[model samples]
Target: MRDTQRTILVFGATGQQGGAVARALLRAQWAVRALVRDPAAPKSIALREAGVELVRGSFADIDVLRAAMKDAYGVFSVVPSSPSGAVTDEEEVRFGTAIADLASESGIAHLVYSSGASVGEKPTGVARFDTKARIEAHIRELPVTATIVRPVIFMEMLVRPGFGLDKGRFTFFLRPNQSMQLIAVDDIGKFVTAIFADKMRFSGETLKIASDTVTGRELETILTEAAGRPIAYARFPDEVLAANPYLRQLAASLDEGPLADHVDLNVMRELNPEILSFRSWLAGSGRKALDEALGTTGLGL
Candidate 1:
């Protein structure tokens, strides 16, 4: 007995996590409204065609956010961070906190903030990771029912170009024997939709989410099987880590365990029965991305 009239204001709807959330919410018969910078964009049009209401604005505009939040039952918030160089860490914190503040003021019943898995009780010394910690703290202080979802590294990221996919070899943050958790972007939507569906259960909860875990060696086997061609896998070389401060910090964080995902796969399976494993993703949603990655000459270490 869900209310079909209830609407969820979704940020980043044109992007991965938001798009998945929008689609999932729509499938569950919830009205979805998205804040987009351009209503004319093809993705925005697609969202509109998919029955999402598009509100044109940026996160910097509080008025736009307030307008979008008006009468909305819930909000799905996911803001992009650095390396995209779209916003500084400070700006990210500001935007995230502002969304929570406005949602609280607008009397929205639930606000789900999507954060990174590496974020925990303390700062990871990485700007992006620390930035989310600040926002999470601020959300807790607000007078709102908020659920924080810290999703692990995306399975989609692995198949993206520049991961050595084009060369039939893959280099990533994990060592051969070490394991890391990964989740499909689509499942992030599933998890969020479930959270919205059961506000009482997830309210005030911080859930670290991931569907599957794999080691570097396991990745090789999976990718080889998926590609029907041998695909090798290796950790990023020491020199590459030494030369790139960002990559080095990420690797160091993983080595120290904060960046390594510690998700309860069993609980996740219960919450999202349609959760995808690495092998299933490679065979399904990730197939096109993998094909494109393999065909591109990417800058890999």
Candidate 2:
């Protein structure tokens, strides 16, 4: 945690969660060594400017990971799931496990893994979420002190095109009365930094992280109030779910209760007091994007 000292090798440094973690670690004065595939990427350049050491590497390369971890205090690892279709579930587990194994074998002090919120004591039978389940189990057997963080659904996704930020209406996986928790991408770093700073409290533990919980109706009210328009929110229609198997399975997971009912929001807030509720996030980091998406080139339904 000291400046000009041990380094923390961060994977996915160019992406949202990784970017947040890298920035937070840099701010805390930790020497960050980012294992980026392309060190010349725009975000990678910005990271270099901020004092993060960029080491060109990919998850699939053992030598690359070894070089990155050669003299690191800890490693922040997160594999990209199916969001971009870059890797399948099997590939995700492979990369995640390989990273942990190499980090431990290299004598890294700590390994902080970022997993999805939906992963729990029991699998939800979804390959995407279950992939983390397998990786988490494997990390437990490693010889490194590790902290596993399970983050809730990202709030940024709600503001994207298909979510109705521009049309004054939105579709999501929530019944009018069912509650769901969400986390801001920025806060993920804050919590993670705090975790890295205090190893004794976080080590040997798996913590669930979330900022706010909302019912579908409550989300509608907040979005409406924030946009100064009547933004209605409702669950995706049955017909719509039937049209997309992925959407249908996701909706079913929530309805079955494990996805929504397992988290303790109060504990998360206690751990990271700076956690921003969904509404607060909307009015802050999301404001400019919302303005562009809704005010200028509106998102067409």
Candidate 2 regions off by >4 Å?
Answer: 292-301
TM-score attained by model 1? 0.94
lDDT of 2 by residue, 1-301 (tens): 4665568888888999999999888887889999887878898899999888888878888898888898799899999997669998889999999999998899988899999877767767668888999999999998889999988788887777767667778788778888878899998998888888888898888887888898899988988877777888888888988887667766776777456565676777776788899888988997766665455435431
Candidate 1 clash total?
A: 0
Off by more than 4 A, model 1: 1-4, 296-301
Give the Cα error of residue 74 in candidate 2, in Å: 0.9
Model 2: worst 10 consecutive residues (lDDT sum): 292-301
Cα RMSDs of all predictions?
3.0, 2.5
Candidate 1 C-alpha lDDT tens digits along 1-301: 4464599999999999999999999999999999999999999999999999999999999999999999899999999897678998888989999999999999999999999887878766778888989999999999999999999889988887788877889888789998888999999999999999999999999999999988889999999888767899888889999887767876776787566646779999999999899999988988888888888325231
Query: Candidate 2, TM-score vs. the true structure?
Result: 0.92
Q: Tell me model 1's lDDT, rounded to 2 decimals.
A: 0.90
